[model samples]
Target: MTTLLEGKAIRKIFKTGTVETEVLKGIDFQILEGEFIIILGQSGSGKTTLLNILGGMTQATEGELHYQGQPLHKASDAELTLYRRKEVGFIFQHYNLMPNLTAYENVKLAADIAEHPLEVEKVLTDVGLEDLKDHFPSQLSGGQQQRIAIARAIVKNPALLLCDEPTGALDIQTGIQVLMALKQLNQNYHMTILIITHNSEIAKMADRVLFLKDGIIDHITVNEHPLAPEELTW
Candidate 1:
């Protein structure tokens, strides 16, 4: 598999007056195409910070970042904006769907901006929300709304999909459904996915797991046979 993204000696520091807090301590890693990776960490472990840097939402204070060998660490703000629009998809815990728009419209908005977009209806079907595409966000359940958000992200045909605590606000059953949708995107659509969460149980479904501790990777593990989303409990 090709290396889709790479970070070498990455570091991030936040300065608040005389207090300088180092969030990422010279981290380094490579993400391969079509791989489902879970970044496991507790609160204040810098998981979101790393995901932001990887997705071009933020730049690292030090070290190098590359996507398919193109430099990202030194990319201009405009360049990063283009990179984000063309190559990356982001999903946060909140659905962030426009309440006034129907599910189809919400997903369509993303497809419209994408350089290589998938069919909006097809993407909705892929996420198992085709029947609810005409429903508004307020009309749907939390799980259904999240499915719409997933559809919106996937319709862009992004090469890299970054998710942050996607199931953080969901119940067990609902979270399982959301994970199934994400797993389908990774296995069937072959989308490269990276998810950051504090939930250790979620790690069982990942192809590889990176354990983050105190702003650094404490260890990494590969799941020889990852479980299905439904197999996950807790």
Candidate 2:
């Protein structure tokens, strides 16, 4: 597989007056095309911060970030905006759906802005939410809402999907179902997915698992055969 994204000596620091705290310390990694990568870490290990930097949601304090050989770290604000809109899709722990919008509408909102969008209804059906298209967020359960969020992100037909604790708020069964959907998306669309979570069990479903400790990658393990979501146990 081709290298889709690369990060070299990435670092993030926050400055509050005279105090400077570093969150990422010389992190480096490369993501291959159509790969499913899991980033595992304890809380405050900077997993989310790394994901944000990779997705261009924020810039790294120091180091190089490249996407398909283009320098993402050097991109201007407008370029980053375009890159995010056209190439990257994000799914958060929270559904982040509009309460007033129906499931279909929420997905459509993202589809409308995308340069190359999948059919909204097709994506909803892909996530097994065809019947819930007209339902609002309040009318759905946590898993159902998350499936809708997945649909919203995938409808953009993005090159890379960045998920931050995608199953953090659900029961095991529901979380498994969501994971299965994500797996299916990666399989069917050849989507490159990077997921960050504290749940170590989720790592079994990934092509590669990156262990983060204290803002640095401790090690990377590649699985010869990743298990399905149903086979995972917490």
Candidate 3:
């Protein structure tokens, strides 16, 4: 598999005056194209920090990052903005959809901003939300709302999708539905996906699992045969 992104000796620190709190300490990893990667860690384990850096929401305090040979670490704010706009899509734990907009409209809003976007209706159908696309966010269930958020992210036709605790807000069954949608996206669109979560069951569905502990990757596990999302136990 080809390398989609690479990080070497990456570190991040948050400083408040004289106080310094180090989050990521010399992390290194490579993400492959079309792979479903899970970064598993407990809270305060720097999983979100690492994801933020990888997604271009923030820069590393030290070391290097390259995306398809582009020097992300050296990229200026303008360059990073372009990189994020053109190459990456993000999904958070909270579905950040506009309450006033219908599912289709919410997704179309993202597609409008993207340089090369997929058809909004097609992306909605891909996530099994075609029937509910006309419904407002408040009219949908949590899982349906999340699927809308997933549709919004994928509509950008992004090469990489970064999700931070995507299913954390749902019940076990609902979480399974969201995971199934993500798995389908991984298989059908061949989008490289990186999800950071503490759920061990969720890790079973990943092609590769990066176990993070205390600001460093504790170990890396590659699943020879990954389970489908529905096969996971809550």
Candidate 4:
């Protein structure tokens, strides 16, 4: 497996007045192409912050980051924007779809911005939302809306998919359905995916699991045989 992303000694800090809070402290890791990775941590543990940095939405305060040998840590805002638009896809816990737009329209909006995008209809079908493509977000169930959001992200044909607490807003069954969809995307598209969630059970479906404690990775574990979403509990 080839390395798709790498981070070394990464750090992030926020300052308000004289008070400074360090959120990330010297984090390091590598993500392989076509691999599914899980970052597990409680709220305020900096999991989402790390995911933001990895996706180029935010810059690290210190250290180095590279994507396919390109220096992300040194990239300018314009460069980061291009990287995000061209190479990265993001899915958040909240489905940020436009309430007025239909599922197909939401996905198409993202596809239109990509340099090499997949067919919007095809991606919607991939996420099992083809029949609901004409429905507005409010008309759909939470899981259906989330699948639409996933379709929106995947339609861009991004090299990397970054998910922040993707299942955080759903019931157990609905979350499982979403996880299954994500797993299928990784297998069928051979997409490299990084997911951050406090649900430790979700780690069983990952090729590699990273445990974050107090803004640093406490340990890393690789699963020889990753489980399916249905097999996960919690």
Candidate 5:
């Protein structure tokens, strides 16, 4: 099968007035369609930097990226924006939900912008937030809010889903619930999902685990039979 995501020799460096900080030295990896990939690393290990590059949310100082066989580096910013909008879904750690808007309205607003919006009801149902849709971010719990965020991301039915510490703010029980929802999306929708996390426990739920350090892939392991999210002993 053709690769759905590819990153070649990606490097990102931040310069702050005579100070140069190297985040990712060189990253090279490929993810096939329908694969669940978890990136495990320590804090400040460049995991999120690599994810940003792959998602086109940030530019790589050096190297290239390919999504669905299309060149990301060569694509213009506008083109990349469109690509991200229609082909990639991003779930951030902070939930990124609008505090003022109700859960349902927030999703509906995003759907209005996408070229092909997913069924609002279906996404709400998928995330188990049908009833909470009428609630505002301030009115819901962290886990419930995050579920709405996940619903918004998958609502467009993007080919790829990128999650960064998606369960960071929640407790164990709620975290598992979020992971279960994500796992269901990956399995049922066949969405190629890549998650960046410091939690090694979450690795078991993925089809493959990529251990990253200093922005380089230290090791990659493919699990012949990954455990179900509910079965994961986190």
Candidate 6:
């Protein structure tokens, strides 16, 4: 029941040609430790923006953000870099792997920057990618590349993992495989995982789901026993 991430009265704004746009309007929420919370929303719903703020990737125009009880806004850039490197892991829809580097090399690049990196081989095996280690991105399928991305994130053994449309680029079967790998990690490692996606089917796999619409949270749902990836429905 301990809070791992919290955003209080969060607000974000942008101005364009004398016009002001408010993206998040006084939204507030909290994520508990070891929880897999999925944020579901349609296009332009501010889900990604909210997540960016949570991960220190971007600052909120207003309000407060605390990660493990420390003020995010007060942290220096170096502190935030360390905060992100050691405490948080990120996965994007587009496999953010270095095309020039082999799968093994790309994962190690991230692990090298971490304060405490998990053994590269252990993480690769966990994601079922040990055999694909030396393959380059161009030599791998979309799914394989994504598995590499997951391995990269898990290699950090971070306190919080942020995934944005993790399976957006994969076919259903491949996406499920990826989710299974991620779900297994959540169950075994007890890492706090936050996934942002447009697919409502994906919410069934989360301990809690936050639904957003037009810069506001429309609803929040909690499932005591989340379904496995194979059991999810749209």
Better of 2 and 4 by lDDT: 2
The deviation in Å at residue 176 for candidate 2 is 0.3
TM-scores of the models, in the given order? Answer: 0.99, 0.98, 0.99, 0.98, 0.95, 0.96
Off by over 4 Å in 5: none
Deviation from native of the Cα of residue 18 in model 3, angstroms: 0.2
Better of 4 and 5 by TM-score: 4
Residues forming the 10-long window of minimal summed lDDT in candidate 2: 48-57
lDDT of 4 by residue, 86-159 (tens): 99999999999999999999999998888899999889888998998999999999999999999999999998
Residue range 145-193, candidate 2, lDDT tens digits: 9999999999999999999999999999999999999999999999999
- Candidate 3 per-residue lDDT, tens place, 1-234, comes to 999999999999999999999999998999999999999999999999999999999999999999998899999999999999999999999998999999999999999999899999999999999999889999999999999999999999999999999999999999999999999999999999999999999999999999999999999999999999989987
Clashing pairs in 6: none
lDDT of 2: 0.96
> Mind giving the per-residue lDDT tens digits that candidate 6 earns over 205-224?
89999999999999999988
RMSD of every prediction: 0.6, 0.8, 0.6, 0.8, 1.3, 1.2
> What residue pairs are clashing in model 1?
none
Candidate 1: tens digits of C-alpha lDDT, residues 95-203? 9999999999999999998888999989988989888888999999999998899988889999999999999999999999999999999988789999999999999
Number of the candidate with higher TM-score, 2 or 3:
3
lDDT value, residue 220 of candidate 1: 95
TM-score: model 1 vs. ground truth: 0.99
TM-score of 3: 0.99
- Can you tell me which runs of candidate 1 are displaced by over 4 Å? none
